[model samples]
Target: MSNLSQLLKESWVLVEERHDDVAAHFYARMFLTDPGLRQLFPVHLDTQRRCLVEALVTAAASIDDPERFTEYVQGLGRAHRKFHVQPSQFAAFHGALLEALRTVGGDRWTIEYDQAWADALGLLTSNMITGLEQDADPAFWHAEVLAHERRGADIAVLTCQPLQHPLRYQAGQYVSVEVPRYQPRLWRTYSIANAPRPDDTVEFHVRAVGAGWVSSALVRRVRPGDLLRIAAPMGTMVLDRESPRDIVCLAGGVGFAPIKALVDELTRFNRSRWVHVYLGARHRDELYDLDELLRLAATYPWLNVVPCCTDDPSWTGEHGEVSEVLARYGPWHEHDFFVSGSAPMVRASLRTLAELEIPADRIRYDSFGDI
Candidate 1:
């Protein structure tokens, strides 16, 4: 790792526990410095605050891996186009971030830490700008909702077709969607639940939680024929087809979206590799996509599907958290692991994988905390 990377990670730890406060401070300084920037964000700053802190942490964690870091920030830059972020605004953001860091660090702050962060931010901004400039694609795609089905009171599955150019994306990637009809200017990310199709259509699984503005609109209010805006796809959790190792996929609740897409893609040419999918939910009613996954498993000889329920005693299949069920089946040292789920579930599964002695490189994951 580079000296700046170590410094960046160490400096971040000082303010990590106070992430919410840090986000609040950063935004306050940013809007104070450039009041016009305030209009770019939502009226409710709760989700935006969490997103800011998550972005900072993700950037810091990936800094030591130049390729991964560049890919991440560049994708972030491209995705930010949906917000109409201008290149000039980056300076104000950087200045506010530095100020926020210094204020949060207090007496522990030093010149070396400031310099390292400045350098890190410089790299982040420059790569993001490059991604922005190199992108010839539209900032957002106009998609028409073709179908919507309520899986339960809180969950829904929807499909949409991009009206103009094809929406090309890898199976496990997700796109930021905006339902302007109901929640204007509020966007949330949803994984494309199916592999790319010739008809330029995509699927999403949504579960409305708490007072999520976008998720509620998507699950309950939005209907077929309504128009939605979709930003460019972003995520690095796609399949590694070249790896000779067998695969184990873990999905919790609606995190099945990406896992289903991956399994779909694998079905195309997977002849030799064994693929096991462990789908988990609190109750059997929550495993909305279990039937479809079972049908797929029955059709493919190499595919195996295990449905796990934590809260349902009537369930005849596996009983336990997905991670716990996975633990019983492991000796997974040689298999590649893909995990997608709620933050807590993902964290638990990762901890289990670490305990099982799985190499870090053999595992890839996507965790949905809020959206």
Candidate 2:
């Protein structure tokens, strides 16, 4: 490992527990330094604070892996384009971040740690700026909502037509969406729920969570003819055609969106591949796409659909959490595992797969709901 990478990891531990306070301090310093930048962020800073901490920790954890870190930073850079981030702002943000670190580290802060963090942050910022400059796609795609169907009380399926420059994305990739109803620049991510269609239209499945701004707007307020701005697709959860292993997909709640897209592509091009999909929900009603999945299973003999429901006494189908269900159907060592859902569900699935002796490299995940 590089001296800089090692120093960052070592220093980060000292302030890791104080992340919330650090994030608050960083934002306060940033907005105080440049009040103009305040409008770029939401009034609510809770999610924003958590996102910053999680992103930094994740990047720190990957410092030992240059290739992985580079990809992550580049993708993040491209995504930040939609926020209208500029080169100069990177330095301003770094300054606030350093102050926050120093404030949190206190007695542990050292010249060596400062220098290491400076070098590391400089490199990461440069990569982000370079990625922004090299990105070929527009910051956002203008799309017109062509249709919307409420799957249940909270979930809605939307079909849109990219007004121009339709995004070219893998079946399992997700796009960040911006709704004008909320704060002007407020954006949230929703998985592209289907494979590319002949009409160049894309689909999204949104489930409104309490107090979720974008989800609420998408599920209830947005309608046909409404215009929505969408960021370029970003994610690494797409299929690896090079691998011939059978597939096992674990989806929870509305997490089935991307999995549905993957299944669509697999059924269309790789009909012979054996696939098992375990869809879980709190109850029967939440399995909104069960009928569609069952329809696909009936048409594709190589595909199997298992719906698992918990917290429902009247339910007669598969019962238990997805990981438990996966455990009961043991010996997943040979399958390529794809997991999408709540953070807890994803974490449990990973742990379960690890306990079953599945290699880490064989598992893929995408946990960002609408970040």
Candidate 3:
């Protein structure tokens, strides 16, 4: 237990130290050992590894108690019910995870450390198992894409049809994309851009993050015939199933990707529920998918779409920052909200949420870690 404590603390610090490195290598190691899991991702494994690792590190940093953490970990077991994460796959991931610890930890990872990690891994996986069994399969799941528009240098609105089979996902849940780009091994996160029912191939709202390793690689290098790998679906940041209060959603730039999925799900499931979304962009030129959103708002009687622009020059649309738009729409109480976009955007929105006096139980979001 002492050794386990030491390892847990050290692992936390290590995660803080080289988060991206640890995350990137963690997935690479997993893929190297279990190439069979390769089909479960859409973006490059390297990229996916980093994002997942970072999220893990973030969760670890936020957790305050072993008992609570254990419970929290156990909660994931229920959350993952919709994802269909198999016990066997969880076991395999743990095996690969240990291999990664040894590989990444290198000189410092002794046999004793291995033993400690094995215990920790057992605890973590056990919780996952519990969480995954409760939630029923979502009504929809599948993949399809059709090109919509090519912007500036090279980006396309890959319009997708509904994935008719499988199960549907809540908005905040992001699907793991593992695809063969940048040497046939990449995995990354892409939020379901739009909401679709079961039996719908969800859309991902994406743009070139410019110097990005994966997106840039995809935009510049990858071609039409390539297959994009995606995990069945997983994540903690979905809508609250227990409540039906007024809901507020926040999104920044491309962060809108995941929240959009939630929005659509809300519309379909709680057709009468009041849900609002805030999507942000720097300026008009940087704007994307506005018409579609307006159309959605028009179609959905209970949903409202608020577009916030940093520079709404003509001021035709909502002006000022995203929070201002949030404030204007809300003197809201007991609302469930989701926010997407950059780190700054998340921070700003949190401040907005607090200022609005919204309850702690209502807000939901996924941060891209740009903060």
C-alpha RMSD values across all candidates: 1.1, 1.7, 6.1
Off by over 4 Å in 3: 1-49, 59-122, 125-144, 151-155, 160-168, 181-183, 217-226, 269-272, 312-315, 369-371
Per-residue C-alpha lDDT of model 3 across residues 1-371, encoded as one tens digit per residue: 35556666675554456556666666676777767766656544444556556545544543445765655565555544333456667877777776766666767666776786687777778767765654454412334444444554544445554344443565667664433445343445567766554445556655666556556654555454444545445556776666767777777877877766676676666855787777777776555666767787898888788887877676578887787787876568867777777777888888988887877557666776321
Candidate 1 residues 190-283, lDDT tens each? 8899999888799999999988889999998999999999999999999988999999999999999999999989988899999999999999
> What is the Cα-based lDDT of residue 9 in candidate 1?
85
Clashing pairs in 1: none
Please write out the lDDT profile of model 2 over residues 1-371, one tens digit for every residue: 77877898899989989999899999999999988889888778887788788778877777788888888888788888898888788887889988999889999799999988787787788888888889999988989999999988999999999977968899889888888755467777788988887788999989988888888888989989999999988888889998889999999998899999999889778845799999999999999999999999999899998899989899999899988998999578888989998888899888899889999888888775533
Compared with the true structure, all predictions reach lDDT values of 0.91, 0.87, 0.63
Sort order, lDDT high to low: 1, 2, 3
For model 1, the superposed segments whose C-alpha errors exceed 4 Å read none
Model 2: what TM-score? Answer: 0.95
RMSD of 1: 1.1
**Which parts of model 2 have CA positions greater than 4 angstroms off?**
1-3, 369-371
